[model samples]
Target: MISASAAVLRAGDRPYAIEEVILDEPGADQIVVQVAATGFCHSDAVARAPKFVQVWPLITGHEAAGVVERVGSEVSGIEVGDHVVLTFAYCGTCSQCADNHPAYCETFVQRNILGLLATGGARATAAGDESVGARWFGQSTFATRTVVDARSAVVVDRDLPLDVLAPLGCGIITGAGTVLNVLDVRPGTSVAIFGVGSVGLAALLAAKAAGAESIIAVDLHPARLELATELGATATILGGDNDSVAEQIRKLTNQGTHYSIDTTGVPEVILCALGSMRARGVCASVGIQTGDVVLDGHALSGKQLVSVIEGDADPRTLIPHLIQLWRDGRFPFDRMLERFPFTAINEAEKASLEGRAVKPVLVMS
Candidate 1:
């Protein structure tokens, strides 16, 4: 086992506490990643909920970018010292994984969300061998070091800064993927995105890349709406200004948009996005919702609801595409980042929760 510094969440409603712990060595198919940076995704906050997470002292950040320090005996197609971005876990043998949709893997919840390794044991231990739930999303990346199966990562360009690329693993991918992959927004098409958070903003940017003519952004924050416009939203709607956000969207786009994405996960906000869709339109949801989405049956009049996780992305292929887009100046996701040292994680979390930062990257180096 290797000693490492990590931010531990002992309770859902409390801040993470930095502590020293013992990280177990990589199993046969795992690799030890020396974390350079990791993004604080909203999903990490899910691990703090007592109703959702059963593990104690869990480490939950998943969007990690780092270097391979050591490889397990069964590892292949990866090597030591390679730059990489960590992603969600998947069981490679599942039908979804075999068909290139690993995000929907049958064992996804068990391997990633349950905070348990496939073999059913904790991977980290504190003094006196107290267990710490460390493998959240197969990464637990808010640490100096982590062990992951080879399938949970994508090798990235060595020259690019890991901090800037980390969000590609989850937030950026989910948003952009919903646009480019799931919705496939085409030129001259119209789209409405509710919630101009990291995911929504990424969707807006992807809509621009897809040549969407009427890209609308809806959010409560004026600052976020302004940023959305700067990032390529054709129109911005102040969520609270309108009597009905869905009506405003329909009026703006001439009888609703062809595509809509909701990143807020609020039931009311999702209803608005759903209502703002054209015939046979698609609405993709990427937010974390605690309550059931109670929707009326009449709302789906030829409209499709896509409850997607990870934007239906296979990280291995999508990460590189996003990186290339970044290099080509098409995807400027880095503009939404606020960098902080690893020690100041609580401050970063507060910034993210308070909407002061769209994407907060914790630099571990």
Candidate 2:
């Protein structure tokens, strides 16, 4: 067993508290990771709401990167001391996984969100021997150390900075993958992105890398808009302005964008994303919906609306491609990262909620 300090969220409405936890040995298909850092995602915030809290005394963090401390007896291709990024869990034998769509794996919700272990046991326990939901997204990386299925670990170059690369596991992949993998955004095409937060900005950066001809970014925050402008957005629209945002994008792109992406789940913003696209253009929705989305039948007359999960990305392939782009100075996702100490997890979460930081990473001490 291993002992580590973790941020424990005992209730849906309470703040995370620092506590010493006990970790069980890795299973035959699992590995132990000494987490260097974990990225804060909006989904983590969503999990704190009353309705979403299925497991009490949970340690919820999805995006993480670290060095492998131990490899299970049956683990292969991955060894102790390898650098890896922890992503969502998947059952390798499932049809979806066999088809390279692990994001849609049959047991996705069970393994990733419900915090169920394949072995039907808890990977971690609190001081009183109470089981904690430590398998969140298969990594539960809010802690300094975690035991995770080998299928969830993506090996990366040892030289890369784990803190900066942590977001690649989910948010970054969802954004960039929507453009590169799902949309197949080609050069000389126009695109529009709604809600320029970390995910939207990542999409913007991917669009730029894909050689998009015109990129329009729409957001409610002027500060984020300015950052978008700096990060290669050809045009920016104030989200709720009296002017029609879709029309503005249409005017900028000589009719409408060939593609659009909505990172904000707001119903109105989604409508604008649909309206901003040209005939037959596709729009990918990657955000968590807060309320029901009531769509007009006419909205689908000539366009397509796709609900993308994890950007339809195969992480093993996409992450390396993104890393190469970063090395070539093409995909600079680092600009969106803000590092915080693991002990200041509550502070980091507050910053993320307040928009004081784009991507808050918790670095283990």
The Cα error of candidate 2 at residue 148, in Å, is 0.8
Q: For each predicted model, how many residue pairs clash, with residues at least 3 apart or on different chains?
A: 1, 0
Per-residue lDDT of model 2, residues 45-150, tens digit only: 8888876757788998999999999888889989999999989888887999999999999898888888764543356789878888887887788999988888
**lDDT, candidates in the order shown:** 0.87, 0.88
lDDT of 1 by residue, 1-365 (tens): 67789998888888888889898777788888899999999888767666787678788899989999988888898999999999998988889999999989998888889876454324788777888888898889989998888888799879999989888899999998889889989999999999988999889888998899999999999999999989998888899633488888999988899999988888777778889988899999888764677778778799998888899999989889989998999999999999999999999998998999999999996
Spell out the clash pairs found in candidate 1: 12-48
In model 2, state the lDDT of residue 341. Answer: 96
Clashes of 2: 0
- Tell me the RMSD of model 1 versus the true structure: 1.5
